[model samples]
Target: MTAIPPSPATAAPLGDGLRFAFGTLTVLPVRVTRWDRGAARTGMLCAPVAGLVVGLAAAALGTALLLLGTGPLLAAVGSAAVPAALTRGLHLDGLADTADGLGSGKPAADALQIMKRSDIGPFGVVTLLFVLLAQVAVLAQAYDGGWARGALAALVSATAARTALTLASRTGVPAARPEGLGAAVAGTVPVRAALLVLAAVTAAAASAGAAFGTYDLIRYALAVLAAVAAAELLLRHCTRRFGGVTGDVFGALAETAATAALVVLATG
Candidate 1:
């Protein structure tokens, strides 16, 4: 799949970007106003905003469950289900495909071919099992601490996951294929834009942590660092193994970063 250049007309308005972000990332019934490179770039930049909504909804679900006398474990399950259900498990599918591709250890072309298959491989199955379990477990721990802690963790983790997309789309990043989401958004994020988003996310995370306690502030910082590290590792690994970033890689990075953030928050 050879990469193609985006046309000048690909850019759209900010409202269109919001529509594209929600329409693409969630099962919400928002009408997508555009489907060009400009919209895609703006959509990726607004991804974290959508994530904030999803995370809040998820946290609310968990808090409600707890108030209704549900066990922390069950509340955690419900919280985890919110984003998965809302997103139609798109990120999970990406994580599965990426795991299968990387686990196969094949050359770039063959690995990409494997990822494109409809059937999930052994590696994909195992990866999904472990990742889901980890999410549930860590979320349960967070809930055990308190509703506010659990909700904050969910919100921050989701935002951090989306933040990875902006970094992945920054200039100099190549698309793995000529078509699809990766190609549309690749190299669209300027360094300045990426830095600004990163700073904003960090500030949001810090503020959220401050509401909990001093220890929580330290934990949140650690989680943010872990999320960033996970995203960087995924980007590097995908670039080396698949020649560049792909839609699947973006999905995998989001899930990995979210998991890392949650794990750090739950344990630290």
Candidate 2:
């Protein structure tokens, strides 16, 4: 077997980290210069930054649509579509694959194979339908409240989605596969670093809400909490079912967190 390529020894950590995160996580044109664990570690740690970029894009489109006089429903749909487009729909696809795998009633190895197949199964299709509906419906509700609310909902939910990936990458999590994205990044993050990143994300979300009022601030933080909680439960379930986390599982977790965050943001 060929030996693994070394990390770019000369590159700055921040540059490599951003490249890895954007290159792997989005359809954006950033080139990934290194594939070694160093880059993966930083990539996972910097996931929220990439998520922030995606969230900003989503928020921008939604705000623009609203300013253009589109109805809340249309603006919500636009906002919801931005994340999918930016990620090339990979997370949504992962969510569907994971649902099919879990719903298959097969052994871990067998279920992995089912998820690896190109076509979506009944469970996958149904899960996608409901997940997309939840995202759009909640977004529409936020947009109905105001452009700021809609944009904040989009921004917070998107960031919370990737924040789950960072937490999921903490030291104890194992990769379900020997090869693939999951194995490359799983267990690479130190526990303290992951928690710190999560705290920062949650705090920033609350700060954004604080501009509105104390209640909004509390709900924003709670939205992040709800997102993390939902993703953690799913992460544990997927680990048990699949033997550990896969790329599909990561995607599922992101979508799960994002939808949960949106749902909470729509409240009050």
Candidate 3:
């Protein structure tokens, strides 16, 4: 869901930024304290922080389940479910809508219209099924390695997913519509700010994996890059096809980044 906006907007405080990020991005109880462009810019920049929280929660659940002897498969499912639960499955819904829009092969305006619909079609259903399965498979692989490995997978992938949002909102990315979440946050972040955020996230991911082994350290670093690269590819295509970013496009980007990160962690 979008962040709530009130009148008499002012420049967002640090607290307002955090509130906006959590309030819009998750089912967390935090109330959005501001809704100005300043707040949105900060919110998009801090999107990875929201992701980090989600990832930690997801990792905790998976690790706990494993400690309780549920096995990796079930733990993987539980871990995978956490992000969806926390975000009210909005990102997943966005992904489905995006898939429908892309698969329609209609003119840009028509495709955008299709995505605005509430119902899921064949393209959306199939895309969601495969994406979910892929996420589960990779996460299962990670858990099979060890609970810690699985936890890292959840943590890094979710962070990467949110990181994608930061990049997608970087300056110059137009909004596909005149209103909605995309428009509010579109082009809000300067390119330099987005890169700095990416660098910080990649470094943290690599450092986290270092606890395991040298190989894991490098793998985790690559996972972040791969995730962002995949998302960037999709972002370019979406911009070209839809004429700019939409809320659905943002959701699709998150899922794409998360899936890519998981794949890199599992296989490399």
- The CA lDDT at 230 in model 1 is 91
Clash pairs, model 3 backbone: none
Distance from true location, Cα of 126 in model 1, Å: 1.0
lDDT of 1 by residue, 1-268 (tens): 3344754324467899889889887889999877777887788789889889989999999999988889889899998999889889988999999999999999999999999999999999999999889998999998898888888888888888888888888888887888877887788877688778888888778877988778777788778778978988989999989988888888899899899999898774
Clashes of each: 0, 0, 0
- As for candidate 1, its clashing pairs are none
Q: Which stretches of candidate 1 lie over 4 Å from their true place?
A: 1-11
Candidate 1, residue 162: the lDDT equals: 85
lDDT of 2 by residue, 1-268 (tens): 1122222222239889899899988999999998877888898899999999999999999999998999899999999999999999999999999999999999999999999999999999999999999999999999988999999999999999999999998878887888788887788788898899999999999999999999999999999989999999999999999998888999999999999999898786
TM-score of each: 0.94, 0.95, 0.95
Which sections of candidate 3 miss by over 4 Å? 1-11
Model 2 misplaced stretches (Cα beyond 4 Å): 1-12
Clashing pairs in 2: none
* Cα RMSD of predicted structure 2: 2.6
Q: How much lDDT does candidate 3 score?
A: 0.90
| lDDT of candidates 1 onward, in order | 0.85, 0.91, 0.90
